[model samples]
Target: MAGNAGVSKPRTAAPAASWFGALEPDHAGDSGDDGGNDAAHSRYDRGEWRASDVADSRFLSRQARRIAESGQSGLYRLYRAFVAARAALGITLLATEIAFAWLITSHPQHGAALVLCAVYALATLALWLLPNLLGPSRPTVAARLRRRQWAATIGVDLLAFGGLQLLGGLLNYTALLVLPALMAGVLTPRLQALGVAAASTLIVLLATQWNAGVAGATPLLLAQAGLAGAGLFVITLLAGELSGRLAREERTARGSLAMARRQAQLNRLVLEELQEGVLVVDRRGRVRAANPAARGLIGEPQDSSGESFALAGVAAWEPLARAVDRAFAEGGWPEEGRDVLLPRDQGPRQLRVRVRFTQRREARVAEDYCVLFVEDVRTVQARVRQEKLAAMGRVSAGIAHEIRNPLAAIMQANALMAEDASSAEQQQLTRMVGENAERLKRIVDDMMEVAPGLVPTPAPLDATAQVAAVCSEWARTVQLPPGAASPLTVELPAQAVGVLFDGEHLRRVLVNLLDNALRHGSRSAGAVRVWLGVADDLHARLGVASDGPPIAPEVERYLFEPFFSTRSRGTGLGLYICRELCERYGASIEYGSRGVPERHRNEFSVAMRRALLPDSESRPHLGP
Candidate 1:
């Protein structure tokens, strides 16, 4: 009885600590108390086992609670299932005893056996219906009263079976003892399970001895009871060992599942943020998953959710679908990527598509998929051009430094020789030399502006008035008619709009754009138009558009590139310098067709940062 009552001993802490030690080594030594045995006993009696006796104890309790919540949830569920099974077994045993009693009406001990079965059935039913009546459902609480619980459950089973056996019933009741023994083995520690088996053996021998004294039992009956007790011990040991192994496996599986879920979420987040388009496609040309970049590249609506589309359904994407099919047929793809054209109403777009097959663990060939890495060919070329331009800028800066001194000396010599000239022919020749020297100096200055360390110091200026003044001066210089009928048309905003830009730099950028427009536009009224307006609340737009033929595709590719020009005498630094200056003042310059469809005109527009106020003091210097 003492051994049976020891089932409720608090042994869960040792196992919980051992399992958590590997994960939290720092708290492995914590025993929920720091002062020793006396303090531990005192805290236990006061229900303060989880109190923070020390700093480590607090942290250990928290870690233990978290482990109990997540790791032992499945264990608690299994325990409840076992309890319900016990109830079902009790009801079956009761019905069996009643039927046996009805078959044997003259049996003397039938009434006592029936009464015992009914009481046992009721006890099991109550336990199952209200599990928490014994104590709280938490494992921690259950561990505290395990002895009382075992006594109430398995002890009653032993006593009831022993009673029926002693009453000399026709049905052998010894085999019925296996239920409690198995339950003890699974739910309790190994030692407790063994103790239940030993108690059952003792009950069997005592009952047999009492029967022999009362009804003259045989040796065969004694041997059978001994062998049956031995079988109970074997079953208990095996059940206990198997249950422990299953628990360990359950914990391991749950941990692995949680880690896999986290990894999948991280992979999704990274794919969504990638700049290159990623598409997962199967052999049937069905797109299983597509990232935001892939959707944009395929011209799919971003707001659409969950619905998947096929690449082969659209005519423009048929080339991509065919490429996917070819890859599947060949069992491999080119590592350098394959170019596929998507011809649209606007223009044909080129995409570099690369494929990598997924290696699935299963043997199903239909489950195989390929990941496509899509990149725009134009974007690739732009990145290459940017790198080349960086290298060229460095070389140009060095050459400009070397040419500065020689160019200054030539200009000085030309000026001095002009003063000494005696003939008008010599004077004209000196003037020509001076003009060419100045042009070379301007070119050198433009190259120097491309130096990376240059920063802009901006002040607020009226962009509307500035555009009007620059356009009027340029029209007169080009010998166009004055006033509203001039070929150079200037359109200004109704109100003065201030922009952040250096005064002289703004003038230079506007003049460069106007010169390009006039040189390319037809020499007629309203052919070259300059306009200033507000693009947005935070920006002011200045545009120079011309009624000229569309720029050739080959030339347009390098429109703003330094030293790239179509005319033999043109330097091609005008547009490049304009872009650099605008960038220095937090502005942007781009070339596009700006007019209506029938009168599409080549336009160079600058988007400048709007000033906070129309005062130079209020303007802040911009950074590049």
Candidate 2:
């Protein structure tokens, strides 16, 4: 009985650390208490392991709970099924026993035989009904019930057959003993199953000798007993083999299911982290799958629970829906990605959408699905623009070098012509040629700012003094209306505050800003102001404000774009060159429109790297 019970013990997998070896992670790896465990330290220091290295703990705990809730042993299920089959066989056995008791001229104890058959039928019915009442329980409870049922069925079968044969029964009835022996073989261990077969065979030999009224054992009877034992042994071996195979298959299936689930989780993680928008839509236009990127691209709120984006609800979505439909109609991907324009309060925004078609099989029917990818047009355009500018810069640099020599020759020749000309008109023409050549040279120099090799040499200088000097010089050079009190006002910090910038580059940038402001600014008293102050701990701020008409938003966007200008005579490279120079020296420039007490003004602000100052205080110099 002990051997038979041992057969029910579940086969456990080998120790995770042993079989997994280098693949397994030790729980003690993170602990410092492992003073003697060299293996643990070695593994931790190597640190070449996968996430699943800890699956012994994580996967096993989860798998255990899952199995407890739903898993059943194959042997238990087969045994339960066998008990049900026995119930049907019981009815047939009862009928056969009733006919035999009446038809045969049986001796004493015929009534006992009939009563045993009836009791046997009742036992089979009880066993079959018991499982339904038990429903599902833990593995331990199921195993207990299985053992109880096995014992009861075997006891009843042995008693019935043994009694019938002992009571002068004509039929051999040895064949009936094989059923209980067979059940024990499959559900019990090898030794227990052989014991059952041996025990039944002994009972058969004793019953046969008694029924035949033999004084001693006969050859025929002995041969019959041996044959019955051999048949029982063969049945036991086959059942054990089948049950072992079933257990192995179940183990393999569970392992495969675990691997598949882990793979699914990995795929989900990658999809969520992707930058590109991804959407999967079915033929009916219902979104089946969407990543965070896709949700953000559509301007949909995170809390919105709508499953499908209706094409008719918004005009902006119609183009995307149509592109998806077109991909489906063509039974492939679209030749070109669709460009969509969405209107917003700021302006019309551009989006580029591409669609790919896929076929999915559901219930043996193929259904078409479209995967839509969305990308912002500005992002794509910006990347393309940068590449184009890089190539153009290289070309422009080469051209600038080539043109400088020719321009110098032209200027020198025109200068010589001015000395040689006799007539006033001829001299005036020569002067005009020199002026235009100088202007062309300035344009080339401005354009060359975009050249990749242009690097600024920054130096530490007093920002307050520089701002005061530049503003005063600019006002004098522009020669503002003399009668109208000076249009320029200077605001500088008291103490000596310094910043890192190329003095020459800074001067040129200030001059370009002042020149542009003068052309567009109001010629009223105190209309222009330049202020210098600390922007932050890291930067020194210089701002130049002009009481000029506020720049239109449309024009402001391209203000610093190379070759873009509002004035007909303007080179369009002035502001661009200023920004380039500022950037090269670890500084930045930006423009904004502001309104003062009496006038609206456009302001240009520059932020430069702040230089460290000494602790000693010097007298403050107030500048106007």
Best by TM-score: 1
- Please write out the lDDT profile of model 1 over residues 543-581, one tens digit for every residue: 888888888778887888898878887778888999888
lDDT of 1 at 157: 80
Q: Give the TM-score of candidate 2.
A: 0.57
What is candidate 2's lDDT per residue for 153-172, written digit by digit as tens?
66666677677666645555
Native-to-model Cα distance after best TM-score fit, residue 292 in candidate 2, in Å: 3.5
Best by lDDT: 1
Cα shift from native, residue 345, model 2 (Å): 8.1
lDDT of 1: 0.70
Clashes per candidate (backbone, < 3 Å) = 3, 0
What candidate 1 gets wrong by more than 4 Å, as runs, is: 1-72, 103-108, 122-241, 273-277, 284-287, 292-321, 341-351, 359-367, 375-445, 451-508, 517-536, 543-558, 580-586, 590-603, 614-624
* Local distance difference test, each candidate: 0.70, 0.66
